[model samples]
Target: MKNRTKELLREGKRVLGTWGMLGDPTTIELAGIAGLDFVLVDMEHTARDLPTIEHMARAADVVGLTLMVRVPDNDPKTILRVLETGVQGIVVPQLETGEDAARAVAAMRYPLNGDRGVCSITRASRYGALRPKFAEYVESADRELLLVGLIETAAGVENIDDILAAGVEVAFIGRRDLSGSLGVHGAAEHPMVLEAQERVLKAVAAHGRAWAGLVPYRKPGEEEWITHDVPFAVYRNDISLLLEAYQNGVRMLGRESASAHGQGGQR
Candidate 1:
């Protein structure tokens, strides 16, 4: 399948996406319906398993959304298992060195480009139906698959240059873990955290790579958070979105009902 997210990046367009933490295909489908570029199924901090990821991929396919997954770690076997489910890419978390980045990339592709296990019967190749020529599929998958190296640890920031130079298409500045790592502890807007993020993004831009992170919808300074140089951006996650919407709706209705009763409007 054509990875529309990669195509958008190639066109120098902003690729907005969200996390599918609920492990529900409907969230993946909703992300597409909501005009997102992709759905990053969060296996790193959620209960989303391989089968759930595969179902999300199927839902993404139906809606023409690019499906990517965040693996729990930098393990090749974990990445390989995620790729076999037909995801467009792998977001390997806790990158600390160039070798970590390269190893993650190698696990996403086949020989020459990398050493991914061969299996045409997997959903990634459409179970051998869509990709009739195995060789052609291998080449295309290698070229089209996206590899994002997550920079959360202090060591990752120190080795930013080498990490990006290791062929990471996108360097994600995970400010939550980053802040915690920096002893800021959830203070994403702290000066130290902000500086670290800037350093990482600057490194990515210098290496001719892209930077990624989550941006709140319609928040003040949102525009400042996104830039032409960084094409990969996520807009919150499925669980949070649902929580916000439902909470707002309930609060609004509850306030209105309370006001009506206070005004003695009820029969």
Candidate 2:
């Protein structure tokens, strides 16, 4: 399958995706069919566990979507377990320092450079059966897999420079949690939050790395749209988008009903 996320990032286009907190395999398959660049299987906030995540990853792969899992923390065991499920990428949350980011990279790579245990029969290795020219497959897997470090806390912001220097390919800003950490909870539009975002963009840009973030609004402001020089943008989650569309439709129908009743009375 093509790694659409990596392709978009390389082409410098804005890759769009949604959060998959609802760990249902059918929901993931539906999102893939909807033509999203990727879907983040949120393990941190959702009730999803390893087995369910593995199934969801395979479902996404079947539909040509790049599956990325947001690991709960920078735990090596969690990283190894998810990667073995054949996910294209891993997003490590609460990354605060260069060392933390490096550790994530280590967990993704094999030993001699990292501590990941070798397993030739895992789904990532195509169940240990070679398709002729197996070495090529291993090389491609190493090159295609991504390591994304999520910067969400005040301390993470303080150490942003070091994190980028650690060679993480993508630095994603967790806007909701970031705002709270900056003492401006739910104020993503606050000047403080905006400035923090700017700093993050600058640091990542300085190192020639990719960046991504979430935008609350459907129609983003000019700065929000451009800031971070964001190559990939995760616009919203499935549940939130569904709720918003449903509420809007209901409100519009009510307005139309009131207008029609008034016109009838006048006639």
Candidate 3:
């Protein structure tokens, strides 16, 4: 199976994604079939546990959608356990320095790269079914595992260079958190927030690493981020989409009913 997320980035293409915060495999499968390049399993703000994550991963795999998890934090055990669920990548939030980035990468690697306690018999290794050739599997995983560092604060933006040097494949700017960090809470498009984001994007590109971020779902004429070389984008979330669809339908129905009532009275 191809790591569609990284593959698109490597090709200099924008990869579209959606957030799977509902802990439902059905939503994940729907996203995959809808042609999303990837789904971000949001463990950070959700109640999803190991079983739920594994199910989501399986659904993503079956439909050819690349799955990545935003781990709760940089905790070693949490990182290792999530990776073992066979997700192709991890998004480590709150990356404030080079050391933070390094620590996250270490949790994803073996002793030579970092101290990740090894267990050949896990979902990541196909439960040891690929043994003997396990060395190759490990090497392939090392090369393919994407490390996405979330730059959510002013300090993280300032330390972008160090974060990049510490082996992050992609630097994702968390606009909401960053706006708060800039003291313009919720104003992701505030001048100060945009400037800080620009700085981080520039630094990430200068170091030959990729950058990712969120954009409002189909915000009119908002293609500048891609033009600026952000390859990964989370367009929206399942819950938001669901709510929007229902609300729009209700509004349309109300308008139709009012129009019918007015027309009948006139007749």
Candidate 4:
């Protein structure tokens, strides 16, 4: 029943996290140690298995980081697998309409709100330890566990109002993918992309739901999300950060070597 990410949002505090695309528990642990509020394990674009998510969720729990996972799609079975691991939130990708968002919500909730299959013998129910208090757990999980919808397409932008009405607690409009959907490819900064982002986010905020975005490292454009009053941001993924670090090291060495050669006068 502990959800630090939701608590932070309720407390009017900024919720910062990084993507866990590497499928390593250590990365989730490191994010927790680094003071992140959550770690969103990526299953949409990664080879992360269900057991890997369970392990990462375990690491996140130990470190007090709220564990969230992006399911490959809005499938009940997919959502069920992660929830069993005691993960606190679910993110459904390529969410395009209210029906899609509603389906995702129903996949996570227990009836009479949703139809998610029940099993108290799972980590989320304390391996049957909370079996006696299963009803309470169900209520708490339904009330607190976040249901996030990813808006990454033109259709999503057009239907944002409906999406919000469908009970998506968080609307994370992914600009990178939205850019591609809008025919901009990698131009997340294109006017069309930025315009659609603002449109969807404005609707998300207006509907009294939290909004999230991916902030680019060292880009002034990244600050727009903050200034626009977004409460959640994922500061790049672990893989991207590592790649940048390595690339920087190589660039530094090359610069140093070039400078030394210039000073040596063609030696």
Weakest lDDT window of 10 consecutive positions for candidate 1? 258-267
Question: Who wins the lDDT comparison?
Answer: 4
lDDT of 3 by residue, 1-267 (tens): 258788878888888888788988999899989999898889999899999999899998899999999999999999999989999999899999999999998998876887777888999889989888877887778878888889999999999999989998888888889999989998877899889988987897788765656554323477643335478778778987876676578687764433345643211
Clashes of each: 1, 0, 0, 0
TM-score of every candidate relative to the true structure: 0.89, 0.85, 0.90, 0.90
In model 4, how large is the Cα lDDT of residue 244?
Answer: 66
Better model by TM-score: candidate 1 vs candidate 2: 1
lDDT of 3 at 5: 80
Residue-level lDDT of model 4, residues 1-267, one tens digit each, is: 878889889887878888888987999989999998898889999999988888998898889998899999888998998899889999899989899988998999999999899998998888999888889989998988998788999999999899889898888878888999999898877899989988977787688755555554344645533435578778778986876676578687864433345643220
Q: Where does model 4 exceed 4 Å of error?
A: 216-227, 253-267
Preferred candidate (lDDT higher): 2 or 4: 4
Deviation in angstroms for 172 in model 1? 0.6
Q: Report the C-alpha displacement of residue 101, candidate 1, in angstroms.
A: 0.7
Provide C-alpha RMSD values for all models, in order. 5.5, 6.4, 6.0, 5.4
Q: lDDT of all predictions, in order shown?
A: 0.82, 0.79, 0.84, 0.84
Clashing pairs in 2: none
* Candidate 3 positional error at 150, Å: 0.7
Tens-digit lDDT track for model 1 on 1-267?
578999988887888888777977988888899899888788888888889888888899999999999888888899899999989988889999999888988898899889899888888888878556888888889988999888888899999898888888888888889989999897878899778888887777677655555443343556544442567888777776776676578587864433345743321
